[model samples]
Target: MTPLGTAVTAGTERAWIEFRRGFTNATDLGFYVVMSVVVFAILWFNRDTVVQVPGYELPSATYALPSFVGGLIAFLSVLGVAYALAMEREDGTLLRAKSLPHGMTGYVVGQVLRTTLETIAGLTLALVPAMLFIDGILVDGVGGLVWLPAILVLGLLATLPIGVVIGAVVRSVRQVNTWGSLPLFALIWASGIFVPTIALPQWARVVGQLFPVYWLGLGTRAVLLPDEAAALEIGGSWRPGWTVAVLVAWAVAGVLVAVPILKRMAARESGSAIAERRERALQRTY
Candidate 1:
């Protein structure tokens, strides 16, 4: 097989291997469940809150569902990939991959596949409970359900490579907490996930509009909520065209920046570096 073909095949196999390992492990499952549980609980508790928007009359929690889901997409794509990359490098996965021809390509392809599947799984865990208990979440019924996958895939594309860049750059998983998780959480807050952007300060509205997270939430809300809900959004509209453009732009930019950085990070992986990282991890356990 050609180098590209070989890399593709290797990556596919690698993704499957990672998925199986992750699903079977208790810790991995917990990591997947905890965030979803928190979000569901928050939405569930707020299910009875009065929603008094003009012509926008559904359960308030249902309206908020899109933001939480979008934020989860951002969280899993960016922070999840960063942590995975950081942990794998420390565990010598990269070093082992380095031994193969075009290994970096295969490794990256594997990560992309692995993380996308994981994101879908994580999203399902969160949304399933919301759908079951939170009435009116699927306000548009069958039509809205059709839009869910497209919105999810778009949101994932918009944010996944950003995670790749972060994971590739951070020195360690500990650093990911400071650099990756903190900043993502900050964006989640500022991007109008938990609160409406219109309700935020002018500075915050602009800042929220500048990122894919906001657009993702907006796109999600556009799908799940009724047309009337747009009246509650900034500028009193969903602006589907703008949401798609902005998300596509972010996805393009993230991929452009992430590719070379991922290659550089992979190039730096070596047996000695992996051994040193392992030693540090071992020390941390003591």
Candidate 2:
């Protein structure tokens, strides 16, 4: 195989290994279980309440559930990348990669796969239960046939690169918690995850619409919610064109920006730098 092909193949293999390791790790498995329980509680608590969206009537849980799922994708994509990069940097994983020819390519590809698979694993925990118990999720219809998969794929493409950029820029794992988690939570709240964007003040709603999280939530709702639910959305339509356009725009922009940043970050990685970080981390632990 050519050098590029060899790197990609190695990356793919590394991703599989990481995926298996992630599922087997006790801490990681427990985290997934806890998240599943949390998501189930959210679904169960809201199941019986019928939310009166301006022109529609549906179980409030049904309305909130899918949007929450969509928002989770963005959250996982960004926070996962950020935390993984930061932790690996501290542990000298990136420095090791810097030692091999074309290793950075493999490292990045493995990360993309790892984050995607891990997020899917987490999603399944909530999604399987939601489908079995919830009433309004579109399991078998035109929606199930088409829009559901399309929106999911688009959502991943749009959000994953942005996550990588955040991961590349963060200086430490703690900063990921502070800088990454705080803004993401704020976005989730502002993006109408728990309520309709239409209900937010005009400016707040507009601010929410500016980001991919709101569009992801909106697209998921479009796939699952009935036509009348569109009444609660801006523009009173699914606006598939806009959804695709916005996500694609972010995807393109993220890739364009992440490449240079990642190269710069990788260039700075060295044995001495890794040792310094390790020493600092060890000192903190002591």
Best by TM-score: 2
Worst 10 residues of 1 by lDDT: 135-144
TM-score per model over all chains: 0.92, 0.95
Write model 2 residue lDDT over 1-286, tens digit each, in one string.
8877777888899899988998999998998898888888988888888878665688988888889888889888888888888888878898887677788998899888888898888899867787688887774487566878888888888888777777788877888877888988888888889888788879878888888888899989988887788878887787888988998888888889988988899899888887888788789899
Model 1, range 1-286, lDDT digits (tens) per residue?
A: 8988998899999898988899889999998788778878888788888566785566768878888889989998888789989988888888788788888788888988998888888888887887887765554668567667777788899999888888899888899998888888888888888877777888888888888999999989888776777777889998988988998898899889998898888888888888788788789899
Global lDDT of each candidate: 0.84, 0.84
Please give the TM-score that candidate 1 achieves against the real structure.
Answer: 0.92
Off by over 4 Å in 2: 139-144
lDDT of model number 1: 0.84
Cα-based RMSD of candidate 1: 2.1
